[model samples]
Target: MTAPARTSGPVEASPGRLFRHRDFRLLWTGHTVSAVGSNMTAVALPLVAVAVLDATTFQVAVLTAAAWLPWLFAGLPVGAWVDRVRRRPVMIAADLVAAALFASVPAAALLGLLTVGHLLVVALGAGLARVFFETADQVYLPTLLRPEQVPEANARLHATQTASYLVGPGLAGLIAQLVGAVTAVALDALTFLLSALCLRRISAVEARPHRGAGTTSLRREVAAGLRFVVRDPYLRVLTVFGAASNIGLTGYQAVLVVFLVRSAELPAGLVGLLIGLASLGGVVGAALAARLARRLGTARTLLFAGALTGPPALLIPLAGAGARTAWLVLGGMLVSLGVAIGNVVKGSFRQTYTPHRLLGRVTVSMHLLNYGTIPLAALLAGALGAAWGPHGAIRAMTAWLALTPLILLAGPLRRRRDLPTAPS
Candidate 1:
């Protein structure tokens, strides 16, 4: 549980020098392409369900649920497997498999064979690939940079993802509007191909072959990951806080488009524009995250970011039916900023604190908690919106947000200032 040793002096990274590391640059490029593609599908998949297939509230919920199901089902086994193999190959293979899966959509559409079932399959496959890619990236990142460079490396990664949100969804909106949702998905598939190419170019020291009698059985490996997290008071508190926040946010996301279309009475094009504008705040937040972490210390910065992000749900419901749309959009932007900042702090700390060998399991375990509740939240949000209307549902979600931070405040988070510096 002890952190690695550090030098006596403050850790420093050269200005923009992290990018000068060739492997990191390649990894960044690959992820950037994949991120844009992922964002496109995030927008495109729902549109296909709603627009083309004319899916109902519950059906749309199913699409969202399918996207997260892999984390629940495949997280632990995949994490164990990643630890036993070369992470780069896992990442590359994931990209290739994902590309093939995504490409099937446009092909099926062209053949007039597309259906809700086909869409569900694509969601499942893409989610599985995501689990692998993310697990590998978490395990592989420390190998590509020095310990001192982790915060900066993570910041840049966040920035790329945020930039994709800012650009990709808007672009997907336009493409979806012009050509169709399936074709827009083709663009996402191409990004995966690009990611695979980038990953293929990365050279690193692979995990050494397991020579001793492997004592880490799957169940034991999973339990160890769980034990490591539960034993660390900081991680334990953060996990609980994360689970609560995700529940609220996922619930809100499940019903967001419904609110925009039904209550706000906005057109699809206008909705896309509003959502894209809101994501600009994420870009700004990512840019600021490293500086904020350095200034506020990691734990305090994370607590502040979490607290700032959650209450914005109230604004969505409070913007009266008669209020200007601009006000609601501005509030959304602020929420994105807060969430982006929180993610940067948490990701950096997790990467820095966890040992490389355990990274995959720990990362997957964390994700399993963070994302496994999406189905429940999505179902609740959809049903509540249907039964009570979008405004009332949003109000209920705001209540959940209001209560989440209390979980963090009551735990070790209240007194924690910074992640422990590595021992010298």
Candidate 2:
């Protein structure tokens, strides 16, 4: 059966009017709380490995690797499950599960029982919940907002995420410095509970159930998502560019903490501050993205945004050992700005082009490519840095990033103009 058709019209401008849509408001609130909470883990988790456990560089790489491994292994299967289930329930369940897993860390730490093994288990569990929540979110979004309101809705989501990055790390740092890293993580768990509550308030039609004689095999469903992604011109191009960028960015992240500590001679707490400050650029970039696309045309905007991101990889490694820490921070902020713009442009384009029926499959397929290799790149960066030094490894990665523009040049993306204003 065909899904119910939706009417297209301009979204209302007033925030009050937007909030009156109860389901949208609830989703927004849930996402906001979850974003802040997730950022806390982003800051606290690595610190736990480095400061508390006194883990080696290779051990830290393992911690990062564990968190990302599930995406490579389970993303496609999770997407299939999301498509066959009600997204709201999946999102709520994911939040509750994540909260429970995150809370375990503090409990163990307080009991003097925290170990690298425990950390790895928690990270893997949290990553599994993340996969479910992310897959459900992509499919749930269109149901919450009308087509005309997608850009606005996306902008609000991005803004909240940016705000979370702006505040979450700095707050985590302060909490970790004063109380402890494990305690800081506990706060994130509380936020997840709140997110779960918010998600429960959303009311929408459930996804249609599968109609086959029986449930399809996981391997078959996974292959179907892959085939669709590989065959679609737009998705294929996006996956290529996204994968290249992620590989470079992951390499940068792998060595970034060590570089800041050794070459830049900065403290860990101060490093968090620098990262928080840099995130302000993301907020600015997200706010301006739609306007820039409207003025420049989507294809040109994407190319310009891609070029903007590539040059900044060179800046991070060039700062050298000096009191010029402020310059390093500034350069990093510029890089963040470029990435934020590219994300908004790419996100808008993807949502506009993808068919609603295949949205869940396509989104998960894209994410699998975007994040699957993060661990591999992280491991490579750590090993290379150990052998050749962090500075040299970073330089190599920066040089690799220069090739990212070639993805845009080679695809139909090169010939495309502005995205279609009306639905396909």
Candidate 3:
């Protein structure tokens, strides 16, 4: 399943080259639009909590927590379920479900009925939907392209997502400024619908899962995914690293709007614009990942990328009035850049290394560790923000980031030049 010879190149060149494949085009388009919408809410939802509901710092943190809390409860089971089903329909259904949930926000807002409770419910429902879509997506992408195309495909996808991070927030701010945050959230609903439509158009017929009649109990199936990860040194280490990294990353981000707006007293538009500009680093890192991997070797590149992700946080907590705001931008950009490269490498590795039938479960199992800490971190950040102030909370979270990369060095990665393409 190597890519065609002519198609081999760095992923930064992928956007122009990969378009020749029809299914990849659909997958790309669907994810691109969807990413823009998702990032819009990344800015809009918090603004709604801040401006529309006038929510407390703790309450805003709860909104962030609710969105991710589902993973802790449902992630393992959902991975097993997805592995037994056709991934595309599952994704489509998740999209439709998410659309309806997000759409409820604007509808409620327009009717003069919006509340923090409503926003929390929407976040919970949307988070559940995300569990399904993301699990299916990791398995689905490979079916549409050769193994070699995966890195490039991932790069293209990550680049677009980063671009959306670039554009979506600014647009959200403009919309939030002109109309309201509720209205900008409605745009997220629309993006889900469009994503569903595009996914339906992808013509590839996916192979059905082999877990047919008389298969093991769902619990065992779930455990199998967990077992595989726990037994594999690489997966075991990566999972732990992901959990630790997320605690820091999500903690800072959960209350970032509050920090930038209430503490620093930046306007909503400026807040959105600043985040958008800083996220440009992700786009840059995604483009550079392939060449960097080639140059530094995968294993070492990961170490370097891992290093970049953390130390920059010291800059973020130092952000201050006027020109000093540059600290947030510089720190955030480096974090984004480091994270982007690390993700491209990690994503491609997971997809290529795992067995096809186990892909969904394995992907989700890993994400369970990666995303599982998010809710707790959000709550912790909120509490810290409420008690110690946003600056104190951010400094603590960023400091944690500076330390998490040491987890990678503890793994076998330090001894290798590159991560092996297939498990031994």
Candidate 4:
């Protein structure tokens, strides 16, 4: 798309800065809706399996694994494809397809045909769509705004995403308690339809890149993207840290619902409210991330985020009856806040440092590593839960999270104040 005019350096942000950018506002609103829908399923889908199908803890976690597995299967090739094609259309198609997939859950329920298998298939289909959408969305942001505005844009987007976490799950829980978890998927589907509709209205012109006079192949293009990420020290280290962190992060997430419902004896609606409240940390973090980066320097802010991300997780495992649930909320809030800050800083850095031509590839290459571990982590959590018990599994996984910050420290991020504007 014809990007907004360039700003020579970082620009001062004022109130209502985003409202002034029409295309950005449209894009932001679309994704904000989509994110809320996704978060709703994040709570409702598992509830369907656990409450309706009486699925095992392992099976519930398997749903999570199914959702993230596509990152391993399609991430690299999809990234390459996104680089060659127009990103906006890819995003639009992904939203439409995901909407249809989620819609099937309620339909099957009405037909008395809902099963764990159907949910797994829907999760996988939606996840495959997510791989393409996220890669393209990452690159698409830069196309909408100038380099100077990227941080602000990233922060704003993250704020809504975090806000979705705060709002979506509570809504999902209430819906699940009132209607049915299956019906929640229907709402999720409707949100995606709106997302697709909004996306279609953005009037920006996406620039298409001409590729390989006649020699291009998916395998070769995937390799090219992989090489770029691996060859760069900063990118390579970031990928490693992201991969390591997700292992622990996803592990706990896989079993969190079970822990709350069974161990803590919380109702579905309360579970949603508690997790949603814990997610409020991201709202605060997103609101402050850019200012923190500006004040503490980007590199230090990242390290600071890492420090906040890991240690408090131990409280989750300690969560018990009554007031003890506060431990889980506090621990989770810290983790969410840290992740939000890190994401805002890292997202802006990646978009600015990477060339426009390579943005899609580079973004996905990193995500390939970041998200690739999610399935494994989910499976591990399930197995651990089965073996030890849900609380024990959470304890084990969060302990790993406590150590992930060490990986970031091992890199050169500690040597500088701000991450460099361009790749070294």
User: 1-424 in candidate 2: lDDT tens per residue?
Assistant: 6453332222324556667888888889989988988887887887887789887666666677777878898898887777777788888899999999999999998899999989989888988889999889888887777765676677678878887877787777777778877877899999999999988877776656457412778667767778888986666887888788877777766776667666677666776676677577778877777677777766677777777667766776765455566655676666667677777767765665677656677789999988898878878877877788777777777777756867877776576656443233
Runs in model 1 deviating more than 4 A are: 1-12, 207-215, 318-323, 422-424
1-424: candidate 4 lDDT, tens digit per residue: 5443221223446538766888888898998999999999999999999999999999999999999999998998888888788888999999999999999999999899999999999999999999989998998889888777888888999999999998999999999999878888899999998988888999889776755512588777778778988997778888898898899989999999998999888999988888898898999999899989888888889899999888977788888768988987899899999999999888888899888877888899999889999999999999999999888889999999999999888887888777777754
lDDT to native, each model: 0.78, 0.75, 0.87, 0.88
- Count clashing residue pairs in model 1: 2
Worst 10 residues of 1 by lDDT: 3-12
Which number leads on lDDT? Answer: 4
Rate residue 82 of model 4 by lDDT.
86
> Would you list the clashing residue pairs of candidate 2?
none
Q: Give lDDT for model 2.
A: 0.75
Q: How close is candidate 1 to the true structure, as a TM-score?
A: 0.93
- Per-residue lDDT of candidate 3, residues 1-424 (tens digit): 6542121123344556688988888888989989999889988999999998888888888899999998999998899888888889999999999999999998998899999999999999999999999998998898888877888899888888888988999888888888888888999999999999999998889987774612889888788889989988887888888899999988988888898889989888888888888788899998888889877777788888889898887788888769988988899899989989988888887887788778878988998988999999999999999999888888899999899999999998898777876666
lDDT (C-alpha) at residue 216 in model 2: 76
lDDT of 4: 0.88
lDDT of 1 by residue, 1-424 (tens): 7555431211447746887888888899998999989888887887787778877766676777788889899998888777777779888999999999989998998898989889989998888988998998888887778888877788888999988887777777788778887877898999999999998888766656355314668788777787888777667777887878877777777776667766777666666666677677788888888788777777677777877677765776655344466656676677778888888877877777776667777888888888888767877887887888766777787679767877777765566566655312
Worst 10 residues of 3 by lDDT: 4-13
**Lowest lDDT 10-mer window, candidate 4?**
2-11
